[model samples]
Target: MRPARLSVVTATTVAVAALATVTGCTAKSDSTAGDGAVQVIAKDDACEVSKTEFPSGHVELAVENKGSKVTEVYLLFPDDRIVTERENIGPGTKAKITAEVKAGSYEIACKPGMKGKGIRQKVTVTGGTAAKRSPEMDAAVAAYRTYVQEQADETLPKVKVFTDAVRAGNIEAAKKAYAPSRIGWERTEPVAESFGDIDPKVDTRADGLEAGQKWTGWHRLEKELWQDKKLGADAKTLADELDKDLLDWQKRVGRAEITPTSMANGAKELLDEVASGKVTGEEERYSHTDLVDFKANVEGAEKSFELLKPVAQKNEPALVTELDKQFAALNTLLDKYRDGADSYEFTSYEKVTKAQRKELSDGVNALAEPLSKLAAAVVK
Candidate 1:
């Protein structure tokens, strides 16, 4: 068995408030098998079937886990875009993932323990089957892509400003440029997170640095500019490196896909960040700008929700409305600390009372309740 390129991520106790189990935990699907759904059984060693060819259109892959451990299946395109995926398949249960696919060569991967790659099979889809499209799904993906592109566009220039300030030893200007610069990064975090190497450089927390890996990026600059009140030569070089990374990311506009399942999971991931990092004040420990990151996370998650609201409304209208209201309420609650219009300033993290932080935490969990149901409702 070849080692998988992916790492196992475990969710914490905080996630229980929003999700019954964290993402990788076992989840059995109770969905009815559609006519287009293909059943693929997973066992202890290999996938039951492999290297199959199929016609395209509305393609559904029903993956059943007969293995003792939790497993997941991914249908991926050549460019590394995940077209469809079913995760958390416990032993003796099955789940289905449906996607509108086109004529292309794809790969199916089964991951046992949700860790290393179990097995992979190639799939060749011929052009005879017409490509199918869904207006709702298309619109949602387009919106998310546009949002990512816009953020990338904005990030290019902001990063330069921050880097230049650091080079010039302008602590005040660098500090000013830091929080707002992070907004665009945070808003498009789902895509940023896709590139594992870049994400840590863009937003690595100071305390979480691996042994021997030098800490850089926003938090590193945060310490130099705020805590030490000095910007050193090393920090300046890091600033330039960070700027380069952001511009390189800018060039990848429209490269990623924005499926409903991804959006649903992205929203949940953003809130998980809030619960684990923002509310805990661990993300911006040096500068106490956790509120800024919190706002951007909410904005990102809210954008996902807004994009998929139409589809969710069609299936669960009341839940959609309540989700909207909850989101709005959460935004309203966060707005109390807003101190600047164009400046994007907010009350410092330390200044926010424990009660107010609790309110924010409560708001996130509230939104997560209805938001969790969105993927299942829209995927069908």
Candidate 2:
């Protein structure tokens, strides 16, 4: 099952601040450090921020997880729309988060177990004009929006094919459709996640569900087809529900908020997803189709980086060069698992050795480090 990206409401104003982050990607300092960054200490029960307020424009959060469990920290708008977030911070580790916020009221939430609403701390951003972005950045955002829309458009029909097989009780056919159905969704997950209500209804895993939430969507059907080896009484109903939910996603995707920073940040989020779930073999435990999802995530990240390359190369040529090299290295590694150059057919994840997994993890981390800085580079 995938690590579910939280859905968010439309926050007309905070759209510009959607600088998503992952562990080890953000930087800031304050009294305890330097560089005008706010300090965040995340404990098992308490979340502490060094400052309750700061100026608008660029802000950094320096987060240290003192908790035993892995934690996630988020910057959220008043209605809890996520402005930016960093996930998968291990115990005793520190990470930095950078965001571009307009003057407004916000909250910092730290989820110790990386679940639920989390502990919230109110924050205020003092008045300042919004950052004036380069035309290239605007062009990148426009292009990314188009890309996201195209992905959404392409995903719905594939999902329908999978659902149709399920409703027909053809387990083998449904299994065949599963991995292909997810490619488009995997490629633009963050955009689907921003709808505030759609993702949980469609892509959520069994473990990722909240209290009172029903088990539905792709994973639920996957379990019935692969693990149970028979159609559950509810299988057809679940398939219909999955089809309906993804239809909702296809309709609502074009309205999602998009920004240059969001595109860059989202690219990093995809890498983080691969590192956390796909490489670990947690996302597709039943089908062992993790490699297909891994490829899609990398493709998504690469698309975003390519769109913003012109501006990022100008601001940090060395970073862009390193990013290109790492991406090539990772793609070459992935190609080894595929049936052919253009096929999604891959060796099952269960057949992969521990060493191979580690190598994949290392490659993702390598690419992620440079991708993490893409948002800051483009916005500059």
Candidate 3:
């Protein structure tokens, strides 16, 4: 889960929110434009677009934040479905988003504090269809869909185990099942988050709660099991709620919108998840299972990269090589904390030193730089 707190970015900014994983978007500081990309200038209260109408096809939005606060820019369908977005764009920074657009009416929203229903601007995509995809790209999309469904299928039973222990008032058993229960969800979070409504119910942390919003999710139960050190009637009831929410997720996984660029963008989003929450020790404050979640994020990112490697190799061989090198390096570093060769058990995040966390953070940044270009490469 992403923290509600915003971090300042110095050079370049990548998306940190789960909803930002929808389409092809890359975060960069420089606004170098030679290609036909629309310029979007975002101020604290106003959002200005270079053009409101463009032909429907491969559309690109170069977003520049002139605002004082960290901002988020979204390409939304009329119904507010996020087609693509770039979040955590710090003051004076820039980001670029490339999306597959069909002829339709849409909105451009600029959210200054990264909160509320943002300032909206109407945009119309006139006539041509979204560019046709190659069979290889179609195969990639289909494979990724199956992979997401598999993760959802695997997650249900694990979550059931944890919830059953909670319902039975077995604190020790529940604690044992906690981290393992979250592995599948953490791995494919962007896909689950695409549903929008499901995420806050199942994963919202106390600090991340909105105004007047009740805190009821895994983290709430996490606080009870670890911080309070006891399970009560409320905890039992929450376990049931959590189970019901996840069951809904399982039923809806098949309907999620999946695209080749979305997969690549999503891989980078998982790394952003690590940098924002897992490495900071904020995600698992009560349980200290941050390492388990950290490893799962990397694994998930690697899965997407690996699936798209064939197309990426054909288009950007150098990028594939560098990604290969960096992914191996990061995995090697993570392996240092594993309890066994094939085990999910990891050294608690509390035991990891500050210096070690920095090393891990550096490793993530190293890989993220190249992985950020994956979407552009695949679309080539």
* lDDT of residue 40 for candidate 2: 90
The TM-score that candidate 1 achieves is 0.70
Among residues 3 or more apart in sequence or in different chains, the pairs in candidate 2 whose N, CA or C atoms overlap within 3 Å are: 1-283, 8-196, 26-96, 26-97, 27-96, 29-37
Candidate 2 structure quality by residue, lDDT tens digits, 22-119: 12222223466466788998988777777777888777788899989899888887766567777788999988777778898887888888777676
Go through the candidates in order and give the clash count of each.
0, 6, 0
Global Cα lDDT for candidate 3: 0.81
- Give model 3's TM-score versus the native structure: 0.88
Runs with alpha carbons beyond 4 Å of true place in candidate 2: 1-33, 340-342
Q: After superposition, how far is residue 316 of candidate 2 from its true place, in Å?
A: 1.0
Clashing pairs in 3: none
How much does candidate 2 score in TM-score? Answer: 0.89
Model 1, range 126-243, lDDT digits (tens) per residue? Answer: 7767543369878998888888899889877887888888898888888888887888887767676654456656677655554455676777788888889887769868988888
lDDT of each: 0.71, 0.81, 0.81
**Which candidate number would show the highest TM-score if scored against the true structure?**
2
